[model samples]
Target: MNPTIKDVAKLANTSKSTVSRYLNGSPVKKETEEALKKAIKELNYHRNENARRLVRSKTQTIGIVVDSITNIFYPSIFRGIEEVAKEKGFNCVFYSMTSNKYKESYFQNLFFEGHVDGIIMISFSKRDKQELVEIAEAGFPAVVFGDSAGIPNIISVDVDNYYGIAELVRYLHRIGHEKIAYISGPEDAAATKCRLAGYLETIGQLGLKVNPSWIVTTDWSNEGGYHAMNQLLADGDFTAVVASNDETAIGALRAFQERGYHVPTNFSITGFDDITLASWVYPSLTTVKQPFMQMGMKAATELFRRMEHGEEYPSERHLLKPELIIRDSCRKISEPIATLK
Candidate 1:
């Protein structure tokens, strides 16, 4: 028989648990790491794939399907996931899919085909989410960070998108912006639904009128924001803008300058997701800050609990709150003097 983990631990003068932890990807002291490495080399001890499969019901790895790296929110969330996974001795495997077609199939093949022990999908589109429900209904552990179909085996973590956008629109209204141009993400996205609902609902609540021409939907990207802004300008007559995200806001800011409209002075603009770029622009952005990394960490924690307890793992849904960051890009205008001189 080959030397098992016990033999290696004994040679390294360490407890079996320490060896196990190290093997599972947990952090170990430098001295212990060196000792274990030396002992494993000397004993020629290697993990038995067949035995591991027979006795242990885990791969000790996690799979995270995230949105495109271009989205500023995904990186923050990825860090939170990686941190928790490391503590639990589980390594992470990440796959990024931006569009509808890419998200569904890439994650399906990765999860059902036995590549990872569990999976977490972040910021996925709405229509593609039904596939996740099916996977969870089959008794597999699946977690979604943004929007999900709310199945039993799936843990859903959602940001308070509805109220967050509603408050932003109310703020724009409070500052005397009656005519607002709205830049939207792709219509199929769950976020688009939530954000748009907030905008429309809040506009009605405030008794404000919205022109149909002022709404333009596009991909959630910087270039998408740019194009959307140009289209809005062609047919729009508004004093304020509510962009879908920071990238979109940044692009719209540029469009404003190219058209000789100074931000906050001529047009007060607000965006969602207070990304790093939100502050670095010439005039800082006024936007909502979603807890991206915290959400990721929470999802990972939930995954670990389910992995250990299976049926006993409590299926919980978390809704994180969003914060409003006041900056120079959005300005207050008097009701009587809404237009810039």
Candidate 2:
């Protein structure tokens, strides 16, 4: 009778899956690998062609897909992924898709071709949701760092954008600002939708008027925020502005400065992300701080779990908390002003 993997596992005093992982060149404990080797030699086990075909060798590499490398938010996440991968003796490969769905699909296919053991995607396009769902259904090891949309099968780690925005809005209201404007990010982004929803719901809950002109949309860029701020100034009057992220907030700050309007003094503005530049800039910035590095580490950890357990791993969603960092950008007001200019 042929010596099966079960026999090797029984002799090595480990799980059959552990023996299989050792044989497949996946990460296993050194002691377990040594025991498996000794057991295989003792059993004179020669892996048959069928067993070899059924068990594929792992590349011991993980692929990370991001929107853009130049974005300030991604480095910490990359660092987190790197730290975890190093501990597992795994390598990391990065793919910058520039928010393109086609590029995302292309890199995703690389995993099927055995280029990577798993993948972690950040800020994926909404249109790619179906594809992602399909991959998870097919038992691909993947974790996402954006809106999971309550999909039970897909693993994701995300900050509560709605809560963060709502908290910021409440803080602004407490500081005596009634007429607040919102500068949103791309419409398709999950964070944009959540943050915008928070803004709308909170404004309505606070009985503040939701001005049509006060809500403007822009991409996640400083230039986009600048142009959007300019448009807001032209359209209506508001006491304060709520930017989607730190970059936009900084850009809006520049716009206010260019027009000779002092932040918090003339108009109050707040941003999200609480990036490095948020503090370094003059006057600083009051924003919501998302756990970027922690999100990355959690996503990578989940991916490895999925990879190790395959379809047996339970689906999970890690919703991280956001911290509201109050700084020099906003001020207490006695009443809502009629206009900035």
Candidate 3:
């Protein structure tokens, strides 16, 4: 028969309540503790009834809420969080909103109902942040990803998007490509604003003309990118295009190919977020490498730290640097063509 609290308490010659508190890691008398240990060993018990009870009494799992699971970025981030959570013996439960307001609210209620220990929210909007603030103010632990607005006790992890986009634009200008176009993500997104600021800053520094027609914003979807690219191509005379993400870039690439436009030869293309598929696509992609996994891992680790210590080690924003990866997709205008002597 499996060992029970009654069996151990009887063997230790102590009240069940005392044994229960002792096994649950509560303070106990030195003499009673020794008796419990001896009784547990004599019974060859490998588990703690009190520990099980404690676990059952509360939900010790973390919640991860993301905008969309279809995006490659979210999955990579999820993997990072999962790895760290597993190492720390914590379980992760994910809820995808698919950018729906109602679903987001539903999950927020789940957290409030004691279904999770804490949460890591990705790609939250202003309204989402407001709701999250309410939860945080109520003393719930959470770490928000990619929000620039500073909230007390709410940890954040994001990339240096402005700098990353600036670097890409500057690189294009350095290669003598002056007529550049950009396909931006949702205008309301903080990341989109930062990246657009980078592009504008670089254009100004290089004394390049800004064409309003060249800047386009759309949902970060393949079809959105494809349609946006087609519109940009028709409206402007651009030699290169900068997409908000690899998916958009790939979509643009497909549009170009379908229209018989050669990548890097006829036009230069660059994408943000060096997703796995970026390199797999034909002609490969030149993009900014966002450390999605590292960001997620750090977010989870930081949340756990806060939970364990009741306060974060340091309450500050962590902005990770993004690197630009050069590939065949972007062309340099300086290349010399063979001329007859």
Alpha carbon lDDT at 173, candidate 1: 88
lDDT per residue, candidate 3, 161-245, as tens digits? 8989988898888788999999999866778888898898888989999999999998887898899989998999999999987
User: 192-281, model 1: which lDDT tens digit per residue?
Assistant: 888988888888899999799988998878899889999998998899889888889999988989998888778888899888889999
Candidates ranked, most accurate by TM-score first:
2, 3, 1
Give per-model TM-scores.
Answer: 0.73, 0.77, 0.73
* Poorly placed runs, candidate 2 (over 4 Å): 1-51, 96-113, 335-341
Report every candidate's CA lDDT. 0.79, 0.82, 0.78
Please give, for residues 142-202, the per-residue lDDT of candidate 2 as tens digits: 8878877556777888888899999999999999989999999997777888889999999
Question: How many steric overlaps are in each model, in order?
Answer: 0, 0, 0
- The local lDDT score (0 to 100) that residue 74 gets in candidate 2 is 85
- What TM-score number comes out for model 3? 0.73
What local lDDT does model 2 show for residue 179? 91
Best by lDDT: 2
CA deviation > 4 Å runs, candidate 3: 1-60, 96-114, 124-127, 148-153, 188-190, 311-314, 337-341
Assess candidate 1 and give its TM-score to the true structure: 0.73
